[model samples]
Target: MEASRQTSPPDSISQDVNPVFFQQLRDLDIPEEAAKQALLHTGNVSAEEAAMYYFNKLENEEADGDLMYKMVFVVNMDLAMGVGKIAAQVGHAAVGLYQALQDKNSWREMAWKWDHSGAKKIVVQGTSVAHLLELQAQAMSLNLPTYLVQDAGLTQVASGSRTVLAVMGEEDIVNNVTGSLKLL
Candidate 1:
């Protein structure tokens, strides 16, 4: 898959990438960012090994194309929020998750990939606050970044009500977490 890699390091891996292996990867026609990530993930392993990992990731559509990453907003249907309120809550969840991801090394990379890969977002419904928490837990266990948006009392929901949960990760893994939920 084609990738317009950013100049910034992938996954915040600031260490210098091995020049020789990088060349080898480029020789193999792998995208620069994907090559860098493959090298980072495989450590000091040889070019062959890193290339294998890269191809495998691509085969799984976890590399840089298709639905590589996505952000999911799960709204608490239990709340009696107006359409505007739900929109506001989802907006809050998106901004909150983004702010939170900036400080995270790996998650920041996911954000970059998501932004480049169409920034797919799905708004789904949750039964209640408890259900949101359960989904958040499931997402976290898979190493995905999650943000649960709590409402301020001035809004439709009561103060500290879990109005939305924003989860970001690889599309397939995220599917395992909230794929069953009905769309909002």
Candidate 2:
């Protein structure tokens, strides 16, 4: 007996990808930005191949010792933002920091290690915007990456208000800057 071959409808195979790409991205352990770039550069042919390409590109970079790495998000307590707003501000800070570091080869290995090691993050409360600015300056002096989130004024705070500050560096060094602040 001969078996007939079954085929899916033409429309069923979308020209554009759906949720499956997300799973592929997760499985490949590629950052969203890098994955997107790889997909674009490779004509979206294969997630595994794209990830390999990106990883190979980063292989030459050196990672610091396995000492803990931490990203601290500092929110302005004086802003009195709602929980949702605070969360959004933190997200903004994180993405900003990621964007700032994504292009630098020196940060590639650190980012990879951080992602694999659970991406340790701590949210702290800052006394005020001025205090947060001071912390940003301190982080800059220490050669750490810092991102300050400014509100658009469409929702809670006034326009250009500094809402949150995100600092990324080795855990010990980061702690020195934020140790006194209370966790949010």
Candidate 3:
């Protein structure tokens, strides 16, 4: 007598977040960064403004290649589920997949590895990209490679994949990579 309802898988839902959502995420980052500067200027910066300021600093430095791409590891359960489902659908080994789901650090490490392997350039994403840039600058001051992965774009495509991580090199070039990531 009762009708049944099915729950949609998480990946299906996550993939639906369009370039517009990415743009909003970028837009929201500005105020968040400013608030953070306001806070640090006083006490606590809003998430958005803090992110924007960091992004700007990275921009001004003219850091290029993998140092300019925006790469993010989806550690959140809801977020990772989408990627997990895709892997599952593709028939990767079950144990390896399960381990990936369970270990956030391992997942991040794997993502980083994939990022640096083939491409000299990398892109970063997520709420943490700005914070990561701060650390990158510090490392740069130490005469080390900051490896700042810049945001490519929401709708743009470089390789066959659409992950935020767009690898760049001397041969492959594009201007205003982050131009697409920020709010107009």
Candidate 4:
């Protein structure tokens, strides 16, 4: 006896998604679950539109009386530093940026909330030293607190090497600067 195979309806198959849409979501660095939820909520609209919807939803959530803080560390991929070296550089940036903000009374509340909320941070890859510097300039233009870490040549990079650029602020504002970059 032969067994019959069942196939999902065309409508259900259409929801499976195209590879290009998934790729776009990956390129945007959206989490897999978030992408899925966005597609579902948006009725499988174009990737760009879905992304906009997702980000808008996030912004709305943040605006509803709960502020979310985020710190982004842009590390120069050209340096090719070892994991330990990169960690050290990020550490330096985080501490330096925190101390700098702590000294300012206006920013102390942000720093305190960030610390209390677990200090959310994302490490993104930068193409080169110039790229990191450009990001720092952009952050400054946005009036976001930024710190650039330069190594002392004790280990991996040369003296005065710009290792990492750290930017800290509200989640939405920080994303405006680092959203295009991919996670390291």
TM-score of each: 0.65, 0.65, 0.21, 0.64
Candidate 4 regions with alpha-carbon error over 4 angstroms: 1-64
lDDT over C-alpha atoms for residue 67 of model 2: 59
Candidate 3, lDDT over the whole model: 0.33
What's the C-alpha lDDT at position 134 in model 2?
98
Mark the regions of model 3 whose C-alpha exceeds 4 Å error after superposition: 1-44, 64-184
Among all windows of 10 consecutive residues in model 3, the one with the lowest summed lDDT is 164-173
TM-score of 1: 0.65
C-alpha positional error of residue 121 in candidate 2 after TM-score superposition, expressed in Å: 0.8
Give lDDT for model 1: 0.86
lDDT of each: 0.86, 0.80, 0.33, 0.83
The TM-score measured for candidate 4 stands at 0.64
Give the top-scoring candidate (lDDT): 1
Q: Which pairs of residues collide in model 4?
A: none
Model 3: per-residue Cα lDDT over 103-128, one tens digit each: 46644543453333322222223234
Q: Poorest 10 consecutive residues of model 2 by lDDT?
A: 11-20
Where model 2 places Cα greater than 4 Å from the true spot, the runs are 1-64
Q: Model 4 residue 145 lDDT?
A: 90
Candidate 1 lDDT over 115-167, as tens digits, reads 75457899999999999999999999998899998888795778989999999
